[model samples]
Every structure is written in structure tokens, then in C-alpha cells.
Target: MKFKDYLHFLSYAKSLEELWSAHTEQMANFGFDKLIYGCTRFRTATSLGDPEDFVILTNHSQDYVDGFLRNGLYFHAPMLKWALHHEGAASWRLIGQMMQNETLSAEERRVYEFNARLGVTVGFTVSFTSVSERSKGAISLCASSGQTQDEIDAIWDEHGQDLLLMNNIAHLKILSLPYTAPNRVLTKRQREALEWVGDGKTTQDIALLMGLTSATVEKHLRLAREALSVETTAQAVLKASLHNQMFVMEA
Candidate 1:
């Protein structure tokens, strides 16, 4: 598809699954047959947040993800370092550069060697613009098997601008979608209760509006707290809001 057509289709992605499929296909057209996109709002110096809370989408095999994401090997991934320190697009060749400079640790070298075995030797990383200090979003694109770095670089030289633009737009589009962690998903009633709490509604007021007893309203709030793993209603409200579950109109 043309660039403009792709942009139009991207804007209408209704769910994370649809967005991932569309993005994977688009990247494949550029010779990148494998893609992994991850984002987190809970990043800290010591943690990348709960894996359950991370928005991780990939087209790679389960074994690759198990070794990389599931097993926590991504922490030692060389490209991850580049993504953390840089904004915009960067070539995966940076991995070789760091290795050549003897800057890679043994664990980092192991991660690269593991990737090499799966033909993840050539690709590019795009670090998305973070809206908050604690948040980060990035994608790694891996060329198809047998496609060397030189060939991938040639494609980048010709279509780099277009690739960059598409990825940036996709990142922004994803941020606007409604999503919540699987383990933290609030039920419709729970979300509604939180929405009322976010709007400063008292339990009695919400009970009257929702046609439930104040005790039942309190029960819903309690369940919401449990689901979100928070200690209080206030924390539940804030956490629900962060997940785009509060104050959202039902479609």
C-alpha cells in the first residue's frame, strides 16, 4: 500500500491485535519479517515495570520471546541500551560497534549470540517520544532470514524516512487506544464505580445513581482495589485512570 493509504488504515485500528497485524505486514514490506514492539509507563531505573502491565506485541516465534522477553534476557540486549539512550531510529549495527569496542558484557554478548542463532542479526530500532519521564516505547525490526546487514542498510538508505514516519505515527496511534493489563482488567461495573469515584462522587451518591445499595457500591470498589492491587479507593481510582478504564464512555 502507499504511504498515505497505510496512514489512513492505521488510524482506524480498533484493537491492539489489529494494530499489530497491520504493523507487522507493513514492516514486512520493507524486508523486516520480524518485529517486536514494547511500551511501558512504569519504567524506573531498577525496573521495567510488571511484565503484565507492559504492552508487548511481537511477530516472532514463541521460543524467541521465551528466551528474550519472558526470560528477561531483553535487559541485556545491546539494542535495548541504544534505544534507552537515543531517540528516533538507529541501526542495529550499533550492537557490533559496542562489541568491537569491548563495551559489551558477557551477558550482553550471550544475548546477541542467541539472537544471531535466530537470524535476528540485522534490523533497526525506533525509540518513540516519551510523554512522561517514566514511560518509554520502542520497536525493533529484524530482517528476514539470510538477509545481511549490508542489504538491510541499503533498504534503510532508500526508505529510511518513510519507515521512520510510519513507525512514529503507529506509536502515537497506539497510545490513544483503550487498554488495560490482562490481570488488572476491571469489569464494567468496576470501571463504572471507579469512574464515579474519579468524578468525586460519594458512595451514597453513586449508589443512588447506579441503583445499588451503598454497601454494594462499596463492594465493587473493594473488588476494584483488589483487581488493581491497590490499598485504597483513591489508589484504585488513579490506577484505573492510568489504564484508561475510568471516565470512559461505553461504546
Candidate 2:
């Protein structure tokens, strides 16, 4: 593959949309059928109405997008969460095949089923957070229908960080956009926890409701802080509630 060609186009991006548009076209030329792009605002002030906002720029059927929104599929996606939090990518088919071979336990089986029905076949999940805050990072890119793991790994080895940086640039672009109201940026989990926190729930109280531990809740808060460029949870929450970009994120 002409991986170097993408590097050439990378130089022409004057804005976030240009960068993503270029990257999307580059990926298709690289043989991917679909490319999903969305930057997550880790925390938002509650004043922003509604939750998360996602804009799909792919040619994939509307059915795929509608199904994704109707069921709120992004929150429950293990691979998506993993890619966003970690620094690497994985094979959905390998994971799915693992389940088929019974390498995973019952819970794993359930996750695989969910992804399978969602029309996901094979893909690579990769992430980059320019700042220390993971939420302030860019959406992990998943290049689907990759014929082999070698190709997928090569994609990561070459452009993984570049793609991540592109997403980060997109974040900055998002911040520059004018809005009638302030934006609230928060992750799906943080948004949910914030609503509960407003209700006066303890971390433990929130954990049980969200099916996570207090530790995990804290991790989300920490990431949210990093993304929001704030020093404390209180500051993060306050900002999240006000930004128009700070989407409610269907938690």
C-alpha cells in the first residue's frame, strides 16, 4: 500500500473537517469500506440540552446509522471503549472468532453477539489523546474489512498516531465553532455519572447504578478532567454543564 501518499495529503489540512475528509478518502483508497469519525468531549456543563452528538460522514447505509442511534449502541461497545482508552487497536473478527472457538466466557459471547448483529465484521480500533486527558482525545479509527492482521498492524504502525493527531485537531476545530449556547462536553459515562452526582449520589451509589466500581467511576472523572483541561472534578462538571458542544451523551 502507498502509505506514504496519505502523508502527502496530511500536509494540506487547514481545518479539522479537511483533515478528516482527507483521512476518510485516504482510508477508502486503502481498501476500507467505511470510516467513522467523532470526537468525544469528555465533560460538559449540564446546561447544554440533550446528551452526546454524533455526526456520521460515511457512505454506509442510513439503516446502519439509524440502528446505531435507535439502540444507543456506542455506550455498550467494548472494542470502542477499549480503543478509546488504550493506545492500540484489535481485530473484531479475531475477537469474534475467539468467541466462536469458545476462548471467551459467557459474557464475552454476549458482547460478540451484540457487535455481530450491529453489522460489524472485522476492523482495527486505535486511539490518540493529544493531552493527558483521554476524553479530550480523538475518536479511535476502526478500518473495517481489513484482509489480514498484518495489514491492520501496518496501518497502525504507520498512521496510528497521525490519525489520532488529526482527531485532536478536529477537537480544536469543534471548540472554535460558534454556538448560540455553550457546549457541554462529557463522555457517556461521565455524563451519566454527572447527572447522578447532581442527584447527590456517592461514587459507590453511582457505581452500583452503572454496574462499575467506584474506582472505574473515578477513572472516568480523571479522564474527563484531562479532556476538559481542568484541575478538579468540580471544575470539570461545571464546564460540562454549560458548553453547547458538551453533549448529554446518552448515558
Candidate 3:
């Protein structure tokens, strides 16, 4: 596909799954058959977020995902370390540099070894530009099976700029789509109630605005809080916004 053609296709991705499939296919054309994209908005001083809340899109097998994500080994991943502290693409060769220079910690060595066992040894990590301190997004481009690190780097030397541009654009587009984990989806009425509250409307005002009784509006608000697992309306609004569930038009 032409460069602009891929960008056009990316813009039309209506869901995360569609985006993931399209992206992996494109990466495969460049000899990076496996792609993993992870983003989190709920990062804190000591934690990233609830695992379920992360926007994780990958083409890797379930076993790899289970070990890397579900097993929480991603926290120790060397690429993740570079991604958290910097924005831009970093070659996985940096891992080797760190290892040889004695900069790799024991835990990082274990993480690298774990990834190597999973055939995740050769890749480039792209850390997207950040707009918030608590939000982070990155994509790992893994060489196709049987490809060596030197071959991947040669491809990079040839098309690294184009690859980076594609990923950055894809990341921006993904951020614009509405997203929420299955367990946190809000009902139509629940979302309406939250939207009203987000606009600073009180219970009575929302009830009148939505043509519902105040009791029903309160119930919707209560359910919205329950669905979001938040204790108060403020937390509900924040959570809903974080999930991009607020003020989106249903199709």
C-alpha cells in the first residue's frame, strides 16, 4: 500500500480490534509481524492502572500475552523502562547495550531472558508523544519469526522514518476512539446522567433536562457510580472521562 493509503485506512478504524488487525498487517509488510500496543490513563506514582483498564492491542499469541501482561512481567520489561522515561523510538539493541555495560538490574535481566524465551528478543519500541503526566502509550515492533536483529535494523535504516510516522499517527487515532473495558460500560441513561453531572447540573436539573423524575435520575446516577466502581459523582465523572465514555454520540 502507498504511504498515504495506510494513513487513510487507519483513520477509518472504528474500533480497537479493527485498528489492531490493520496495524499488524501493515507492520508485517515491513517484516514486523507481531505488534503490541499498550496505553494507560490511570498511571499513578506507584502503579500504571488496573490491568483490565489498559488499552492493550496485540497480535501475539495468548500465551505470550498471559506471561507478559497477566503475569505482570511487563513491569520489568527493558523497553517499558525506556518508554516510561522517554518519548521516541528506541531500538531493542539498547537492551544489549545495557546488559553489556552492566546497567541492567537483576530483575531487568530476568525480564529480558523471559522475553527472549518467548521469541521477543528483536524489536524497536516506539514511545508516543505524551499530553499528560499520568497517561502513556507505546508500541513494540517485533521482527517476524526467524528474522534476526541485524536484519530488523537494516529495515529500520531503510524505512525507519516512515515506520515511526505510521505508529505515531496510529496512536493518535486510537486515542480519539471511544473506549471502555467490558465491565465498565455505562448504559445509555447512565451516560446521559453523567454527562449532565459533568456539565455541573444538579439532580433536579438533570431530571428536568432529561424529562425524568428526580428519583429516576438519582437511580441512573447511582447505577453509573456502581458501574464505574466509584464512590462519588466526581470520581464517576473522572472515570467515565478517562474511559472516553462521556459525551460520545452512539452510532
The CA-based lDDT of model 3 is what? 0.90
Residues 1-251, candidate 3: write the lDDT tens digits. 78999999998888777887888988999999888999998898899878777888888989998888889989988899899999988889999899889998888888888888989989899999888988999999999889888899999999999999999999998888888875888999999999999999999999999999999999999998888877998999998887678999767
lDDT digits (tens) for residues 52-102 of candidate 1? 778888989999999999899898888887787789888888888988899
Taking every candidate in turn, the Cα RMSD to the unseen true structure, in Å, is 1.6, 13.3, 1.7
The TM-score values for the models, in the order shown, are 0.94, 0.50, 0.93
Stretches of candidate 3 off by over 4 Å are none
Candidate number with greatest lDDT: 3
Residue pairs in steric clash, candidate 3? none
lDDT (10s digit) by residue, model 2, range 1-251? 25555455555444446665666666665445565654444434332112343333444557665655345565445665565546534545556566567776565555557556755555665454434342433343445653565676676667666655544444455444422221334567876776676667788998999999999988887877766667887766655553443443222
Task: State which candidate, 1 or 2, has the greater lDDT.
Answer: 1
Worst 10-residue stretch by lDDT in candidate 2? 46-55
Q: Give lDDT for model 2.
A: 0.55
Clashes of each: 0, 27, 0
Residue 108 of candidate 1: its Cα lDDT?
A: 96
